[model samples]
Target: MSKKETPLFPLRKGLHTRQAHVDLPPGTFEEEHARQGFYGRTTHLYRLHPVTDWTRIEGPLRPHCYDLNPLKPSAEEAIRLSMFGSTEAGFAPICLLHNSDVALHWVAPDTMDFFYRNADGDDVYYIHAGAGKLETTFGALTYATGDYLVIPRGTTYRFLPESGDQRYLLIESFSEVTIPDRNQLGPNAIFDPAMVDTPELEPYDATPREWAVHIKREHQITKVFYPFNPLDVVGWKGDLTVWRINVKDIRPIVSARYHLPPSAHSTFIANNFVICSFLPRPFEEEEGAMRVPFFHSNIDYDEVLFYSAGHFFSRDGIGAGMMTWHPQGIHHGPHPKAIPLSRTKDRTDEVAVMVDTARPLQATPAAELMENLNYWASWK
Candidate 1:
């Protein structure tokens, strides 16, 4: 991630230098990239107009905190949690876990035609279900089930789900979302660069009409009305851009002699948290080696896992869209039966996404509504 290694995502010519944005048509647009050498990496941007032609129409969103605090981990019985209510819609996503470094959300947008910009930090959207198109100023990215949409900060975009039902595990990183440095794996990226689906330049010219582009900055949502759609960039080129990758395209590293730690499956990393995808892989086949994860305490991180699909051999009764949290200082592991059951199996099809944060995470009120109160007793 240096000046020399930035050519891996060149969408066009002349965008490697500060003069990169000067080549665009002079009028009717503004250069809007991020200069984050102070923060992390710089992202160049070009927008139809200065994204500042906005009028704040509302107050900040409700504080994201919970009333009841739960901190128990599951050993055998699965602990379930939900974020979406029966009728939540639009840009309103349920905040499930939060701390100083990151905030995790469950978003199911029923009507998603409006634009949105996170003035806060980078966002990683894990699509648990549904298919749709994400139109952003950088370009258009087609997303489906198992796709993780990585959007940088300050990018204006809108999501259009083919159907009204869509489930997303959204992680708002209070810093840049970067690829994990797995130099030990090889000189290549953790996931192959060829597997990434970067958006191509597909500009849309909407007729003059009112559009609501919500801007979230400093924990507040300001509804800004614009004269036209803001995602009108005809071309963009830079190392900093939005991209998508499906879980199926990711090949997990496995060890038959020993159980691999969660870090072996690392996908993306930020300042204080790391996101990993647990895809289908072969189980440990060696004799006397533990097939299930051994009991251990999360001494330095808070772990959150969202079950995506298939049978997870380590836990029982877990379902799709369910989430489990194991905060710092808690010891958790497979059910008592999972170890013996895993010995009878040679492979697994479980697909899950994990977020481990260095800082302790606080649960939201919405997450408390679906907690399995008897989870702690299951180990008995």
Candidate 2:
């Protein structure tokens, strides 16, 4: 018989309730200090006040917020913003945060004269706004807002945006991005695999000409020219083809008597990171269950949330197309003003994407340029 690596044993020795996230001690807040990003061994500590109730934090670890709306790719690209998708200028995507395992980039919709193939990693493009058509090796996928388009590595593809205002948050994972195991929740709990839409075998018919495919490998682009369009896969069948799923189709898990952890909302997972979606849903209905996110320390992974739409209940001064980077070694939770409203509000209309990475992420220069200063002070 094989032995379990981590035994399931709980030794309770504290002034605690029978269940977590419900019926906390009066006038006390709950702070979960856990291991393995709320997956492994855990201890829920009941505190007198909020863990993030800080007056000041002076260091590099302060949380940050970056705006994608009206923010140009760079200073030089700002001048070319109007000229994007034109014959004169078409810029590249601005990298937001990156580490060894995965990186996030903000795609500024522009004309792509050539196809792109990432030999470095697979790309998961979250359509934040606008509509477009992706011509890939598998087929053509018509993408709109709230769609997640996952293109496998080494697949040649290019964008054909209907308008210039397309906004996308691209997650480049060095490892293969796979559907999270459903465990006991079953396969059809959050979403059904049958609902996942794959591209049709509609190849584009264009004039025969030299086409350039920019292959990115090891942070360098190697242009390869072909006499015809590279997305000419007549008919192919494989599990490793480009696929997409919209946020509307995802059904979040919620309980009236219990508040689920962020891991419960996980949509996709890589080796060292996971992507979750927060959709418009009703708050926990039970009296003792907390409707808002509880205070938790980022003990293992760094948390990055990209706000998409709706009124963000736990956050203030945040709008769509903005992202918050709450680094590790910090305690963060609901904002001061948002807490009072959580009592009255019964539902959350917000749509956001959250990525938790095992290692810390480093922001790119473009992210720094677009950051909304003094984000950490918002907690006060």
Candidate 3:
């Protein structure tokens, strides 16, 4: 079918803007392009996620959890040692929701492998730890802990480690992922211009390379098909390609006069939802403000959080590697201890990625086989 003649799926409404106040020094983009050209060498790596016929793949993959104890060589180990080791590799546990549209992936440290693209659905990834290079048809995009990446349906890509040892937390959504709706703000505005911090595309070396494309079919998975790598295209000039922006670049819209609602600093779209973040800044109402996230309900969407770093004062007993899924109907917020422990003024060192979806999410059998069942009753 002709490109323009193809039917288009209606995308939910929302806006994603780069922080206007941030500036990229002259030649930064060019420098990044050059660096990628230099250091990125072509590889013949190929792998695929197991799949079954849609008719046969129906039903829930039982839910489960995993702990990366072996991977943690030391309490202070920042790099994930578990994921890369062959013994515990594919064993990366995941949580599966029966008959829903989402799956939670928890990768232990030091794991490096090909993340197969979904042929039948879109996947959004929320980084939980370490850093790496995502090589895609568009090019290489660098991702660190706390980054969120959306790989639209049918986009082929793979992961490469930026550091020798690192682990990752990945959230895979089978449905279209989007920002929350702006209507919640009552029509004027939310996501203040100052809150978003768009990272400058730091210059990198670039070089030409070739990649192999593998197509999977019922009879047998095909392999070794050569496709001209886009990285060889030498120059790129569009936004429909892979890119990276630091979470810190997303600035919070602070109110000088009144305590702003979480929705005030929120950026909304559809298919899924995301709340930008909070930084160390003065609260609108008091010189020493100890604010906590108010309890709320998402009638239509499931709420999931991937804690990246820092202390989450609002939610008690949560630390890095913890995955919280507050499905519809659950009333969840900080623990009782958190209520009395609120600080008059605080500096937060936490970073995380939060998602709320309008449609119910499903967990794959693979996911069910790897979840931490204990979390199911932790809300109390």
Model 3 lDDT, full chain set: 0.44
Q: Write the per-residue lDDT of candidate 2 for residues 262-314, one digit (tens) a residue.
A: 99899999989999999989998888888888888878989999999999999
* Residue ranges of candidate 3 with Cα displaced over 4 Å: 1-101, 107-117, 173-211, 214-224, 227-231, 256-268, 272-284, 287-290, 363-380
Best by lDDT: 2
How much is 194 displaced in model 1, in angstroms?
Answer: 1.1
Give stretches of model 2 more than 4 Å off.
1-14, 74-91
- Residues 1-380, candidate 3, lDDT per residue (tens digit)? 65676654232222211321112222221001111111232111111211110122223332123333233332223223122111223223233332244445544433223234445345555565667676665556767766656666656666665655455544444566555455654433433334332223333333333444333222122344333442334454654433344566555556543344444544433334444444445543443232554343344456666566777766666776655666564444445455445544344566766555555665444343435665433434
Which candidate would rank higher by TM-score, 2 or 3? 2
Q: Report lDDT per candidate.
A: 0.69, 0.84, 0.44
Question: Candidate 2 at residue 186, lDDT?
Answer: 89
Give TM per candidate.
Answer: 0.76, 0.92, 0.58
Pairs clashing within candidate 1: 33-45, 75-335, 76-335
The TM-score obtained by model 1 is: 0.76
lDDT of 1 by residue, 1-380 (tens): 65665666545444233333223344323222322211223344444443323333133211111212232112111113432211123556667788888998777665465788888888899988888888888888899999999999988887777874577878999899988766778745556888899887776758788887778887666778989877767676679889998999888988777666677888998987889899999987767455666454455667788888999787766667677787655446676578579868889899999888888788765677657754543443
Q: Model 3 Cα displacement at 244 (Å)?
A: 1.3
Best by TM-score: 2
